[model samples]
Target chain A: MTLYSFIFYILAAVILLSTGWAITRRNLVHAVIYLVISFFGSAMLFYLMGAPLLAALEVIIYAGAIMILFLFIIMMLRVEGIEERLFPLKQWLPAMGLGFISFQVCIFLLISAGSEEPLKAAMAEPAIFGHFLFRQHWLSIEIVSMLLLIALIGVLHLGMEKKRKESGE
Target chain B: MIVPYSHVIFLAGILFLMGMFCTVTRRNLMMMVLGLEIMLNAAAIAFIGAALRHGHMDGHAMVIFIIAVAAAEVSIGLALIVCIYRKTGTIDAGCIEGDVCEL
Candidate 1:
């Protein structure tokens, strides 16, 4: 196999296995860690796709920011480190079976469809990406900013009032 | 091309289904959120693969938007999870009782 195909296969395997492991873990923190690995793998795969800007954003935003958010929430909830929660065979087995079966089905479907050959890869440089993002997608950017602001306000509204009462007692 | 476009799509499908399995089987609220994040990652992979396949900047643009949406989602979701823990004293979705959390 070509080096490119080899790298692609390895990254894809890394993502799949890490996510599977993450889901199977009983400890929430452990799961989050695995999720981070999976996200990092996904970011690398994004790099392989030639969208370097998107890949960097995936690493920064998803692997870095999002995971830190998860860890903070877990810490605040005081469920850090190991957990005593059990994943019984009843639940774990069924989920594993479902995941495996779906994986098989997807492979089968992909092979059956007989894919067209992929085109020559193009590098999507950040300079061009930035211009297109701001120029053609300005409206989406504005809307997303508005969404983030509303979410921030909602979170503050949800959190501050409750804390005030709890501390007052 | 390094790998066939269809193979990338297949990989995305596996990740999405694995996420689905996690969401369906897990009783913990945080696990469900993690599952959702995995599902979003799968979507991003597919988008990036499509961009590579077509040599179009539009797919890259879409992936960027997806990242923005995912960030917003995770922020709001984690906030909600923290709120739930504050009010209910637990994050177990299955154990929620008496209007504390609805399934």
Candidate 2:
């Protein structure tokens, strides 16, 4: 009813619509573009959640860097013209059933959780959250950075092997 | 007054459902990857919502870590897709199964 809720509903709608488009679209590039829209929508949701830092990081990292990498890989692979049949509907029936049931459960849980008073009580000092992250969880932070380093090394190794194979042929 | 946190969870659920639809119906490898990204984003939104509801920033920090993981996943997955394409000349999930063909 308020401005924040209105914005939240609008962004949610966009995210849902774009996600549907991303899956159903036949063109690979179009799907990726839809994914970008979905990413931006999620980032906006993050901002609404009182996390401006995460919102920016979502846009910059996921929407910008990661998607660019995906786009580049798609272009390099050049699989646009390949013909493929749609997956059979029977194959997805079980998954669809499970997804529907889980979705309902999730909605129920969220609505019930929202109605409780703990959330209001939980809204104390936000600064304490930062203190916990930078002080108590510093080790996890370093581990994350190390993981990124390993990923980078793996990517470089893959790229070099690819180049070597190409040159050999 | 305003329940912005509730809206966050609602949106996240919708997004998660959409991602599930994508993952279930799509046969294209790239589309599947896109769906996976959507699902990840949905989870991130949920984390952010919980963080806001709790008046904590730790959720945001965890979201940063999630983004890094997603980036690394995209890099490695796309690289593998390229390799597969070079060998098979196609990115359809159907064809790549059963036999390992030469590039």
Candidate 3:
């Protein structure tokens, strides 16, 4: 295998393993930390896949901002030590069985389906990507920004509501 | 040829399955949200792979919008989770579902 493909396999392993760990952790903080590692692995994979801009954005937006937000909220709520009954037999059995079946079916189809051709590595430069994004999806960008603004306002209102209730009580 | 396009799709499929498993089995609301993030990230990975395979920027652009939506969804979802925790004094999905949450 070429260096690029080797790196891709290694990164994929890191992502899958870390994510598995994250989901199984009982402590929320530990789970988020593991997930950050998983995100980092994916970011590297993004770079290897020739989307350097997305790789950087994955690091900044996902591993940095979003995970830190999760960590912040986890700490703020003080639920780190809360004990939870994870993986009840009823839930675990069905999910595991279904997931396993579906995963195998996907693999089978992938192997049997068309196009065994390899992907050609092509990098998307940030400048061209930005221009294309604006030119083609400017309206969508505006809508996303509006959605973010609404989310911010909703969060602020929720926090304020909780505070007001505390005062009123 | 670096690697077959199928390898990338396979990777994404595995990640998506993991996320789905997490979402289905996790009892905590926070973990559920985390699962959703994983699934979204998996989709982003698939999109990037498609972009690379097709040699186009559309998938890259879509990933950006995905990130934006994830940020928005997480913020709102977490806020709602916090609100539920405050009102119910518990973050367990079972408790919430039973409507037996006691503050």
Candidate 4:
């Protein structure tokens, strides 16, 4: 394997390992920290895959913004002392069985398709990517912006403290 | 050429399965949302890999949108989770009536 593939394998291993740790941690803060590492690994993978713009955005939005949001909520809730059944046999066994069966099916289909071609490395420069995105998907961008606005409004409404006095008035 | 496209697909599938497992087995509402984020990240990786394989920008575009949607989803989902915690005094999915939350 060449240097790029070697780096890819290492990064993939890091991501999988960190994500596995993330899910198993009982402390939500610990899970979020592990997930941040996983996201960093994924951002590097995006860079290796020649999506530099996505790499940066992944770091900025996912590892930085989203994770911080999760951290804030976890801190605000202070539910760390709430003991969780990490792996109740009833739920764990069924989930594992279903996951294993689905994964087997996925592998079977993948092998049946039998495409062994290697991926050719190509880069999408930020400039060209932006131009193409705006040119073809400006409407999509607009729709997403609207979606964000709606989400913002919904969050504000949900987080608003109800006026108990108003009910009596 | 770096690696076979199948390797990327395999990686994504494994990540997706792990995310599914997390979502299914974890009783915490936050963990479920975290699992969803993991699944979305796996899908983003797959899309980037496909973009590289097919020599197109479409997959990258999709990932951009995926990230945006994830941001929106997380904000709203967490807000709802906070509201639930406020009403029920616990974030545990199993403790619906607040009896189990002794603290």
How well docked is model 4, in DockQ terms?
A: 0.72
Highest-scoring model, lDDT: 4
Model 3 TM-score relative to the real fold? 0.93
True contacts kept of 1: 0.67
**For candidate 1, what is the total of clashing residue pairs?**
0
Off by over 4 Å in 1: A80-105, A164-169, B99-103
State fnat for each of the candidate structures. 0.67, 0.57, 0.75, 0.76
Flag the better candidate by lDDT, 1 or 4: 4
lDDT of 1 at A22: 96
lDDT of the structure predicted as candidate 1: 0.83
Q: 2 or 3: which has the higher lDDT?
A: 3
RMSD of 3: 2.3
| Global lDDT of each candidate | 0.83, 0.74, 0.88, 0.91
Query: Once model 2 is optimally superposed onto the true structure by TM-score, how far is the C-alpha of residue A159 displaced, in angstroms?
Result: 2.0
Docking class of 4: medium
| lDDT agreement of model 3 with the native | 0.88
* Cα lDDT, model 4, residue A39: 98
Residue pairs in collision within model 3: none
lDDT of 3 by residue, A1-169 (tens): 7888888889999999999999999989899999999999999999998889889999999999999999888877856545566655667677778877898888896888556877877888899999999999999999999999999999999879989989999
Minimum summed lDDT over a 10-residue window in model 2 chain A is located at: A117-126
Residue-level lDDT tens digits of model 2 in B36-97: 88888888888877876766667777877788788888778787777777767777787786
CAPRI-style docking class of model 1 based on DockQ: medium
DockQ of each: 0.58, 0.51, 0.72, 0.72
